[model samples]
Target: MMRFILSLVLLPTLAAAQTPAADQARAAADALEAASNMLDDADGARDRVRALTETIQAFESGLGAMRTGLRQAAINEAQLTKKLQSREEEVAALLGALQSMGGGASPVALLHPDGPMGTARAGMLLAELTPALNARADALRTDLENVQTLRALQTDAAKRLQEGLTEVQAARIALNQAMANRTDLPKRFTADPVRTGILIASTETLDGFASGLSEIVTDEIEPAPVNLDGQIGELRLPVQGLILRRAGEADAAGVKRPGVIMATRPGAIVISPTAATIRYAGPLLDFGNVVILEPQADTLFVLAGLDVVYGEAGQVIAGGTPVGLMGGSLAEKGDELSPLREGTGTERSETLYIEVRQANRPQDPVAWFRTDEDG
Candidate 1:
């Protein structure tokens, strides 16, 4: 009877002792901690906007990791809880049986009806079962510990999520302020707005507008001819995004152009890919907000479809300087967390049109920017 009752406790197979969910949770906590530290360091950085950008990215990555960890932890906890609940009666019976037998510590508890020989045989049998029973006990203990740890981690992760969201928002606000106050870039020449308006009014096509760009130059200070011999195919993209349409590739409407179309997230930063002079910055025809850059004499890089255009025409900006921001409404807090629940990446809702012209002829943009790697 004692053996039969005790065997009931081992009826439920214990889960693996390793706590993968706990490991994931710990890693997520570390990522969040690193993001917090990065945010603190951003205050003293040389490029405040860039620093804040990095900080926001870090916070976003950490929050994503935490969400994944919390989800896995929850699943593991639920599985363990269900398993334990199913064997609840067996566990209770085992405890009662052990208590009645004085936990197998009393010699009288092991005595058999057939006297010494039977008693010895029963003891041997129990010895064989002891190791298996102990192993199950250890695994059960680990499962219970994991459940508790996962519960605590989930609770703590919620607090961290809120903190991360708040910090990222602050960084974004700081970035905006920094961009608005910036005014230290050099200028090759200032553009004549009146002449630019006249040129736009006369031109009907992008080619025609670009060809007459020199007509709007009020300050005709010629830029030094830039030698791009060694940097032909190694240039970074002006914005962080995925290449949606390659140069000369037809779109849904079967419209093909010599430039690539990039899909970017809302409010994503657009930077100058190289040290360049801004030839034009404003709306032109149906291109929406445009910023045409002259990285070299007779070479123009036209960036169109921007929500906001930064820097006036003729300003000499350094590589990686903020140029503009992509158009779209910022996601709310609930929307930011949508990726966690939906298992999808942040949506790229804005598109930027890029055209590279050399010696007045359009060139394939993929030859100028690396597109094999992830944005």
Candidate 2:
């Protein structure tokens, strides 16, 4: 009879061990495994650089989902543990009561001292208490099992995270090598170094420098092959990140710029938003490494604060081409999981500054790029 009661109490715990957070963690692990396979296939791909880029992106998304799931799992485990600890005495008392009832079930113990009527009333009381006892036992078993499952999940997630980090690093290196070997991108025009140098030295601001771009080229420039006016507000962000500031928002230093700032993880890839010719691809005063592209005759897209830049000035690169990488170092192994447990996910430590200039005037970047708050 006691064994039957115990089995009934634990029946619900056999349903499933996976919570929503655990399911998400499993899905993220699957994604990471797929990305690893993609990395292996990239070597023989027709466009190896693009294939590797996609692999890196996949790893990034998987890592993010894993972190979120792990964080949630940690929180759930802590709550269950606290609840169990607070009710420790109550649980012990219940266990002692059950043990006594099972051990002392002799005929003499079953008979009440008062009479047959008293014994009948005691039997009725036991029937009423059975359901309540069963319910509490079931709840306690479930909580204990859930905590155990969550702990196991957290331990397994660490291994997945390490593999993902290593694979992404490999993908990034492969992409860099492939980009260096690439030679097929078309050239719109060749830049004049002396003229460009003179123009930069004479200009005082970005607007003035952009306005004098024509002064650096003496040859008759051909019209842009692609038009981007139809794609306004439909372009995806160059990097996967969250927008930190819209255009004209003041910074901590009380300074404002006509650009949007995006917060991205370390080593994030930055791609071109549209098919455009590189007007300039080097450092400018106070903007760090910068890439300026002209999709049309009078419009310029400026991406700044990159750690590394790609492509050369006057190259006509297609949309979604790799142009740069955001700056930061990857987290050290074993230490990376701590941030996820704390619910911060390594701080999104790098920032990309984006600006759109039309007709020599700075325009709001949100007007050109689609914004997603959740990214």
Candidate 3:
């Protein structure tokens, strides 16, 4: 029974032992589990939306339970403090009385002045009761420790919960908005399935696939009017996002690379910022679906991390032409952000990587596009 009480007090800390690392592992497993479970129970995107919404509601309910538990813990701590204080005084008074009454000399005789057998029996009983009193006193100290631990947990929870509330609101709103934007995107062109599939499957390098696309020349495509000469710092960004990276900066892998990485919204419209000919519009290595555009004879612009590509290589796409859509939470191309849902606006975000090259040399893209203050 004593062990059980200690376990109850340790419950909060034990639960928190599953750190962010544990959460990542659990989330991966849960995603697989959810996918398997949802296969039979779900039908389409709407079903997924409903499932996600339901999960959120369930989490909210758990939050309510946590709040209730915290309230009870606070009340229990206060009450226990009061009870233990009085009990401590009582124990001290009893000990003082025992000492003054000469319990040290002949405890049995002092308690029972009746007969020899009575004193012996009382002595044996007092020996057993002494340990019991000590045990009770030790339990009081343990209870105080438990109370302190519980209060700390509650304090941590409130701080984390307060920070997370703003994030939750922002995430849900962004996700829903992305879904809506995806629905609103106008279907301009339909890709040739057989050609795209063969291209993605057969080509080992992006350059090789781009060369193949360039071979399929058509006269229907129109050239963009953007003048590549003296247009530095005058071009609009190809997509809406926060520029998190600049050219020549080191990435997490510690490699000094050319190009910029933007944290973008899901389902964001990707456009060609100038009159350019498509050099590539397909997947390559870890870049997901990529699109390379050549606005001038010596300049090339690279756009990657798209969910869908709308233009073809050798096709002259005009300035502001919709080239693709940003990959989102519901993106079908097996992107990273999948399995792990979109993060809280910053870390583990949907990123678009862009590059600008002149004569095959890396150049800073920041000078070419307008920078936003929000980033």
Give the top-scoring candidate (lDDT): 2
Give the Å error, residue 120, model 1: 6.1
The TM-score leader among the candidates is 2
Candidate 1, residue 173: Cα displacement in angstroms equals: 3.4
Stronger candidate by TM-score (1 vs 3): 1
What are the TM-scores, per candidate, against the unseen true structure? 0.71, 0.91, 0.41
- Please report how far candidate 2 places residue 137 from its true position, in Å: 1.7
* lDDT score for candidate 2 against the true structure: 0.82
Specify the poorest-scoring 10-residue window by lDDT in model 1. 8-17
Q: Write the per-residue lDDT of candidate 3 for residues 41-158, one digit (tens) a residue.
A: 4335553434433333333333333333444545555666787677776656544544543334654446566787887797798788767755664555465555565556556544
Give the candidates in order of lDDT, highest first.
Answer: 2, 1, 3
Any runs in candidate 3 off by more than 4 Å, and if so which? 1-226, 330-344, 373-375
Model 3: lDDT to the true structure: 0.57
Worst 10 residues of 3 by lDDT: 333-342
Model 1 per-residue lDDT tens digits across residues 1-375: 556544544443333334776677678778878878888888898887677766766665566566667677778888989987887876675466455544546666567999999988988987787676556655566666666666776677767776776776677677778878777877788788888999999999888898899767866676676677789789988876779899889999999999999987676667788888999989999999999988888889999999877788889887777677788885665554343542444456789999999999999989998777444
User: Which lDDT values do the candidates have, in the order given?
Assistant: 0.76, 0.82, 0.57
